[model samples]
Target: MEFRFTVLASGSTGNATVVQSGDKTVLVDAGHSLKKLEELMGSQGIAGHDIDAVLITHEHSDHIKGLNALARKYELPVYANEATWAALERHATHVPPERRVVMGTGEEVRFGSMAVRSYPISHDAAEPVGYTFTEDGYKLSLATDLGYVSDLVRRSIIDSDVLVLESNHDPEMLRMGRYPWNIKRRILSDVGHLSNEAAGEALCELMTDRTRRVYLAHLSLNHNMMDLARLTVNGVLEDRGHFFRKDEHPLRDTHPYEPTPWDQIKRKAL
Candidate 1:
């Protein structure tokens, strides 16, 4: 069976996606309320009952905000690395034992016909990770909430068919943004967030002729303009003789993901 993926939602407001392959379906994260997910799925002619699992990247409220409620309602399994699991355990009380699976960093996990791998990222969180999902010959990678992309992260997502990458800010924008000094410092730290220039730099390492699409993700509503992020990444990628396969919505099936899947990504593979 052929696999398909769609960004149900993104941005700092909320995040989630729907991935399906025949009888198998997965929700990478569910920051949006169950009602929202239901609405998103319905818009795409999907049903919430079709989802089989939910994989979380970190314990941040933006990523886990609606997780417990969804888990309780659907009895869906949720996967995360040890440290992330521990961090979430403090708050994910509604999750039943059967629905909480502690994933091993850098190891491939099976969700029916799909294979998901979590790799460590540069984030301050306990064990944040970027995700790569493969089925048949297609691969989808999600990289967000990271400070930067290192050699390890580059390798984890390099050959992906579709990559949802974080373009969190523009250096100049962040420097001039209204965020307080301390918050600005945190976003610029090694474990903070990826700037547009940084995101562009990272893409240089991961782009390939095989890369069918690239989704710029986790855009800072306050610090970035879509045109700026798009142009920055495209220019950098162009320098590498690469460009986003933009014949479609950037990440929608007919296009795939959206303005950032709001999850915290840190490298575990490296």
Candidate 2:
């Protein structure tokens, strides 16, 4: 089977991703406006009606800003944990009850040829999770908007063919930035976003020969630059003996305003 992944947008401003297996296509989050989501999907030849479901990572506005609109417009099934659904019901009231599907963490759900499993992550929200999708022998894991990599998270994403991990900010830049102290403290806390150095360290333990592509995601526009994130992550990987190469464990970049080109991973038939 062939599995495809695309980061529609990844930053503190918004977050969304597309995961496709066989004929089924799932939108991981609808963080942008309905119009913006449509445009982003259109760029990849996907229509609103083409989506099979929407998966919520948490109830944060940056992750669910367009959930109600997109779900209602497409009549799409929106899967989320119980706590997240409760928070969504209070905020995203436009979504019909029939469209709300409760998915438990660590349970494998099938959407056509794709099997998706959610794992808990430490974030200051009702419930935040990172997802891993598998088809045949190929696996693609997405772990973003997380503060730290727990043992569950590490195990969930192990042996992934593609990984989308967070490298949110640089410690020095975030410390010196003009944000208020409380806001900075929250970001620096374990319940906050992951720093670039932390992401690199986690990757050292996570990346393996099976891990082909890793996209640095959920970057802070003010606290991080694309080049800087790549350089920092690569540097840490190199120092830890994980050399960067285009054909092996290459680091990829994601955009906050656009969609990444579809990355396809194929597995041989049994």
Clashes of each: 15, 0
Each model's TM-score, in the order given?
A: 0.87, 0.96
The TM-score obtained by model 1 is 0.87
Off by over 4 Å in 1: 243-270
Number of the predicted model whose lDDT against the real structure is largest = 2
lDDT of 1 by residue, 1-270 (tens): 767777776667777766667688888877777777777777777676777888898878777878887888877888888788888878754578888888888989888888889999998888888888887767889888888888899889897777888888888888898989999999999899888888878877786656656777777888887788888877776787764445633332111223223222222231
For candidate 1, what is the total of clashing residue pairs? 15
Tens-digit lDDT track of model 2 for 1-270: 567988999997889999998899999988999999999999999999999999999988888888888988889999999988888777755579899889998778999989999999999988888899998879999999888999989999987888999999999999999999999999999899999989999999998777778899999999999899988998899999987546654789999999999999753233
The 0-to-1 C-alpha lDDT of every candidate, in the order given, reads 0.76, 0.89
Per-candidate alpha-carbon RMSD to the true structure = 5.5, 1.8
